[model samples]
Target: MRRRDLLASAALPLPAWASAAPERVLRVGTDIAEVGFDPPRVSDRTSVTINAHIFESPLTYDYLARPALLRPQTAAALPEASENFTRWVFTLQPGIFFADDPAFGGKPRELVAADYVYSIKRFFDPRIPTEHLFHFENAGILGLSELRQRALKAKTGLDYDAPVAGLRALDRYRFEIRLARPAPRFVQLFAVPGLTGALAREVVEHYDDELPAHPVGTGPFMLQRWRRGSQVRLVRNPRFREQHFDSLATDLNAEDQALLKRLQGRRLPLVDAVEVNVILEEQPRWLAFHGGEIDVLELPPTLAPAVMPGGRLAPYLAQRGVQARAQVDASVRHTFFNCEDPDIGGLQPERVALRRAIALAYDNTEELRSVFKGQGVPAQSMLVPAVYGFDATLRSAAGSGDMARARALLDTYGYRDVDRDGWREHPDGRSLTLRLAGLSDSRQRAINELWLKKMRLLGLRIVFEPGQFGELIKNSLAGTLQMWSYSWTTSQPDGDFFLALGYGPNAGQANDARLVLPAFDRAYEKQRALPDGPERLAAMRAANRLMLAYQPYLPHFHALRVDLSQPGVEGYRRHPFTRDWWRYTAKE
Candidate 1:
């Protein structure tokens, strides 16, 4: 598990003199952008890279634990429910406005019900591509299933409008929802970033094509311009409410002191302007941040200086004491396999075979120490300890490959040395070897090479292959390649869904290594139907038992994200799938 205790212990209390004074401008550094302005269409971390000032969500996540809620953020008090758990209502805080309204000309918008309805319906919009649709399935939203089927089939048209029986536009401030069954997290689901953000139907309708590059929401900031594939800029939301910071601050917290010093009645956009610059390479960014040209850097493993060079960052780290402000999901990063191999289930054991071979071949320990620099724990299964369906008791003994075991498995499976030669042969006497393909990035290429060396030792002939990241991902999804490393960014804490959910097209789609275990599917179906809590948790455990019995992929480690920022940046946070979560964070 991540050393959460260390982060909590290192936390300092805010000084009593703290106050929310105004400030302006937050300059940011980011990588490349994906596409889409609408939240539902966005899946890549760098794609939604905007500031909190420009965007906001109705349901905010409570840091204590991740579950969505009806409030803008997770609340100390859970929402109250009616007698039958049938009708769900949420009351929003009084005054809020969108960031770029000409009415406020750049004010936040008041939260309301229709906004939620619009957000929910977008999933069913053939035009809108929301990877989070599974989250909306059980809300008892009218015509959801039919709409989803049509949307998935046609990929456009608002056939879902007529099915509004389960959802309502109860006045302006309050929203009501009916659930088919009780989901404790149905309300909290709204708090999550992608799930509950309310969108103005007018804006989405007007600039539908331009939404991705130009974000419009009731957050603290608004998008001014996006220099595609390069950088983005934002201006503060003039009508931002909740000027007070989150109450979790302590007097000694470094952020409190910094906020106090930076916000002293300054104009919004504290500086002349804020820029979220995109840099694909790491060296230039560190040089800029070090030279004081840049204010913050979301340094990844490939970006962080392994040996703090010359003690240059010592004072800055100590004096600033600003740390990564997000929950590190151990499950966020892992390889997806091509579970759909025909023979793997047809002529051969498709998923289970690949999983067994890859797991046994991978040196998770070495990757954890060398690549991650001991910043992360190795994951042996799809679900990490933090996520549901994860079996903590399952210790992987695969990396310790024994030729005896490898030979035994291959011999029984038909890849045996029937011919008296160095190379093994399949039952049909064909060469028994395959190539491992992965990203050509220096770090990944290096790791891939190491795995190749290890796999060769297991009496298997190995070839190291390189391809463009996108192409490799495409091939993995199509099941065209034998073995490749794949990544699913927004993996859930209780994720067995990628394998069980029937979306066969989401690139490097989860369940790529299609195992087709009925018991696993049944357990997952049970899991999917349950609200995201203990009952779902129990069903997921049973499913994990199925995963353990049938290994599906060579599970890898979640990347431990490391970033460097100058002092005075506050409210910068992270999410499960990203190290580059840009928007929703404020700067002094």
Candidate 2:
């Protein structure tokens, strides 16, 4: 597709009443573009945000609850777990039917246990090539990995017709999963939209390789229209199962409580439609929200000062009756050094020292102050708030830059300006330059400039390779990038979720850095096997300290997420993990 076409929404004819007051539409503006709607194939945040509305998982986190509470979605109730935690059985709620599609041969197909079994197996199918397969692979699900291997060697691809022993449909509504070992946290994995949403077999077979373009699910909304990379529109599913606003004892403020009271007893999916515009630039997105073209806006860090000066609502915005909410986001941004590269990789003493020195020289506080405009706190470690094993007392050795120490370490490692041109050369006297990949945005450019200034002070040369966020992720996964800046937002509240990024087995998957350390890998395994308690906490702490010593990633800031909504909009709550807020939102 042409660039212009990819960046433009289709100009559909508007209804006669489209311009009338307060249409039941919740419009959203997001800076990042989506990859596609395919649940199993997509891993980006933008795509996941869109898909969350179209798909329903067996379980989900409570929408209004703080500290996140798990609740059943398609499942009749929580799964019955065995004493050893090796087996789990779930019963689906009756009368849940998929959205009407030609794949179903003009018949209404009720969601069944077999559909979930088929959906999850697609993650392991080589034909689909899902990046999230590692989540299930590490769960030690009996016979699943073996089944995938068998399909890989067979002439035909994954046999959706065949069944695996671990994933069995006990009846029309009930299914059981048997694991090789105890996975107490396995149930939480289902709450992730892309990881465990139900997929109809006929729909998969009908679309085949084109499944990304044709997503059919049994959620509150259906993808009515999509102009890839530019815009997406979702209409309420007429056949959606009847679900109401469930109550929870949350720490909601008076305003939040008032909004919830107005929404109580109302059937879910209060809005008639949802419209999302993909505005790549933050300025345009903010402007769209300001001009009343969009109902809700996520205030970017670069514009936080103008929107919410001094961490409070700006006077102009407050006078316009805009409500703003700001909280520390459950995420971490960092730059990763590819462990597979010869220049920056490996556990050698010199390489380790060089990496640690670079980390020490990068000033996170400056980035937060200037780039973020005081919208975030300097991250002490990889662990973000709300996740287990995040030690408030623990601090990173490289949190503050130590220029004197950084220079001494480089000089001792033979990385010196041999030619006296004010630039350092490799220990072997070869021309040395570090390449860092980043998005071609003003904010990223500013960040790159900061890094360049720091590197220049140390007599080192660094270059920024600009590309789209999708391209950067592709290159990182391929292990072609030497160093790159990225962020990870946990879908579940587990320390293992972040620590698993350094595991050797997850290379090119979750471990984008391609780190391979046996000691760290062992620690990760030990922590995953234990239940959430002191034992697991101790193991995770050791693993985190080991990563800190290795210095593969320079810990960055955990910025506060700022959200703005017009006063007319109601029942719009921000979730820490799930992004499916459109269903509960409505405009007066």
Candidate 3:
């Protein structure tokens, strides 16, 4: 059967129970295809959004909390930490069972502490080579790094039976983690979906390397069907444990209170199913939502003016009973220079001067107004609002750009039009050309044109090399791209991950810029050990200043997140850090 026909057939209503409430289903339209379902192997936002519903992390952030408060999800309670903060212990909630799978030999498999230990150890296995290994590597776990090296050297592959001292299971329900040093923010790691979600050994062994296709978890939903790159459907898990909505202690507005009252004490997973369609273009996704084919719409910034003029929903949309909510997202979009490339890399004075001059010449404010249609704010520093250590007083030196100063800096560094071709050449009389790796989308094309126009004013010539997102990521990780544009969204309300992106050890992993700075390394290490206070904030500020001085990334703007939903959709709230928010949502 055709792909669309298959999906349409799957949506046919199921027989309803006489006493049970009617089933509610949510249909979401997205412009990007999910890379995979395996949390450790996939790092893209689309994949994370899809997998989060199927996996249960040890800890999760409150859905409606404004400042992002962490709460226990699968655990009975928050883990207990030692006085020095090096050792922590957690006990799992009893009676939790994994979804039914043939790998279990027809018996329901109960989730245990050993499952979490095995899941974390997978990050260190050289065969899997999970991209998120850096998060664990930086935590100073005693034997993890050594075990990874040992497995790489062994003739045979990793032995899942081997026990590591740093990660141990005390019993079926309890486990402890020992860090080499004090890490005050260690608990935050548990909130990441890739880090704490439990995976059964039997399931992993059955699926082997193709585990992304088979996902077994103890969350509210289970993967029912997936037509790779076309569509995916998730049905409510039959073995999911009972859970109810609880009120928060934090202050909430009137609207939020009303939402809470309606949902309090109600069984979770208000929706019975979720259906996602992959439409890799903004116009089609937007149209799908407008035609009532999808329930929720995440409007792109480029289309903000046409759909929401003056930052408000258009009258036509309002008349259709569509509600709009917009807020500045906790993310920073910028262009990263490959510090390993000889032309744009290094810490010499001339190299720094060139980077700073380029920063000064490019205009972010104009792009925010023209390309983004006033839907974004100029980024002052790497740290966005709401994250700890973000100082409101800190500002970027060339955020708005000083054209005159940029010209002077370039001329002083001997970058001039020597051959009179109206473009600058290398200071040493060598040819100089910068190639930017980009995606061939309308929004990216418009942004690239603006960048080209601004760089031309500095007598510099730049060319765009367009490719797929996956190809760009591969090239960036290999350090083959001279420059590229990317963005990072915070998964927690802390600045450690953002600062760790430039650390030396993360070169081929999270540090796509390949920046190696000893100063940044020391500050980051010190900051991670200290609790949230003035001292840690000071260390984070110092690191931010050093990154600005090095100029590895030309600061860009932080865009706004605009969401639209039909009036019938209730209990909908946007989370700053978490995705897969369908559990608390329902439609009339």
Candidate 4:
């Protein structure tokens, strides 16, 4: 059977219990300040940390792991981008009512196609400072650049009088957008992590003259209050819609076999309130989860072993009557090399050889077993283990670790012990010395130490260039640092997307290694051009070979995600790459 067919065929079976339940209140704890509630502002991790309470996308994923259109109007009906990848159309869901807001002294108007267009435009708005615009690069909407320019003007048009970019309101219930490609998943892009509730065009217009303080979005919860650097709070938009895509809960799937079957005609929500609090340090969260002050914990590293099945917290978790899960997520955690920096010595082939040598010398297995407690699998190649075909032959090409062989590569490249002393020297006449900058995290520090030790053994001088994390990030990205070990995360299921593979234009700057091969560039571009899945996979296999052949990066560990819910709070499942929603979630 075809893979996608096998995947789709494994749907959930019918449930026996069927009963309407009340709303649910979910409380989650965090450890830092998030950028803000507005989706287009900054891709701040802390802010989007809480789900259900704020920010909703149009379509969402289902328990079976398929992209389930959340808006009733979108179900089984959204249009596909044409064969040339240039257009898409969608019908607005009907009979939907925004939760009535007494705070408005009135009711919100019915959602329309115009709202979707405006929400999309907000991302391109320069004033928004969207740190993650790559999500929309392939959107291929015409006149989008002009719209972005208008949105970016110091003071500009915040509302649409007429239509642009082939965008038009075909009456109040339907909308269309012409694209530059035959985007198969274009409509589903709305279901990805980037979309948010429609903002009030008037609210943005009112604040156009000044910087936006509090942007309004239509979701289950509204920004009730924000105390900068301290805490932010959201109250149930008594006048809101029960949107399942509320950003906080957007990526976390809420699944219950019995609840799903029982919810056919049932009204959603079992609890009255959902609260999110910011607690920045790990200790308070550890205490709170035990005290039952928070229903869900993001599972920090120190806490990973205890509540997890294998580590120190295993005994405690069992005694506490908690359920456990270890997700081998697609998030490929890796160490990035600053290949372009001149200070790291020559921008050409010299640096490439040294970088490749460093990648080979380190043992990934020891790091996983000792530091990550055998939880991480080696990133022999780019694609995550289960999502795509990893092509074992390609993985085998990574070549086992041989310190002597690695030294020979450096020697071949003219890096040899000229002084006849222990340390090697650059053939260009410079000493073989390099400084590595690393993060303060215990796990990261450990990795850095391992690399330093291995490099030292291979006849090189190594140093740890430490500083405040904020400055470390600044210097690292700007390429002032020679070597770095940092964490890269993702929620995308397929390695074919721009995140892991695509190069040139959103090929992903966060790659940290910042190396782009001509071969990879060709393969990435070709893979997307193919309309068939099998063909795309074939190109990706070739691309994966090109990526691993050089070994630009060494993969470390997977993000460990765990959920702890009180007895009354049921129905929380780990969300896969496509961020899922939670309207059907209920409490006993």
Q: Ten-residue segment with the worst summed lDDT in candidate 4?
A: 10-19
For model 3, the stretches where C-alpha displacement exceeds 4 angstroms are: 1-22
lDDT (10s digit) by residue, model 4, range 440-514: 555557767777678787787788877644466456545577676655444444455523433545423344556
Q: In lDDT terms, how accurate is model 3?
A: 0.82
On lDDT, the stronger of 1 and 3 is 3
Better model by TM-score: candidate 1 vs candidate 2: 2
- Local lDDT at 530 for model 4: 63
Q: lDDT values of the candidates?
A: 0.55, 0.83, 0.82, 0.56
How accurate locally is residue 466 in candidate 4, as Cα lDDT from 0 to 100? 71
lDDT of 3 at 569: 87
Off by over 4 Å in 1: 1-24, 49-54, 62-87, 101-111, 138-142, 150-156, 248-274, 302-305, 308-330, 343-351, 385-393, 398-404, 417-438, 459-515, 527-537, 570-588
Best by lDDT: 2
| Model 1 C-alpha lDDT per residue in residues 84-129, reported as the tens digit of each score | 5656776666666665443333544555667777777777675654
- List the pairs of residues colliding in candidate 3: none
Give each model a TM-score: 0.77, 0.95, 0.95, 0.78
Q: Which scores greater on TM-score, model 2 or model 4?
A: 2
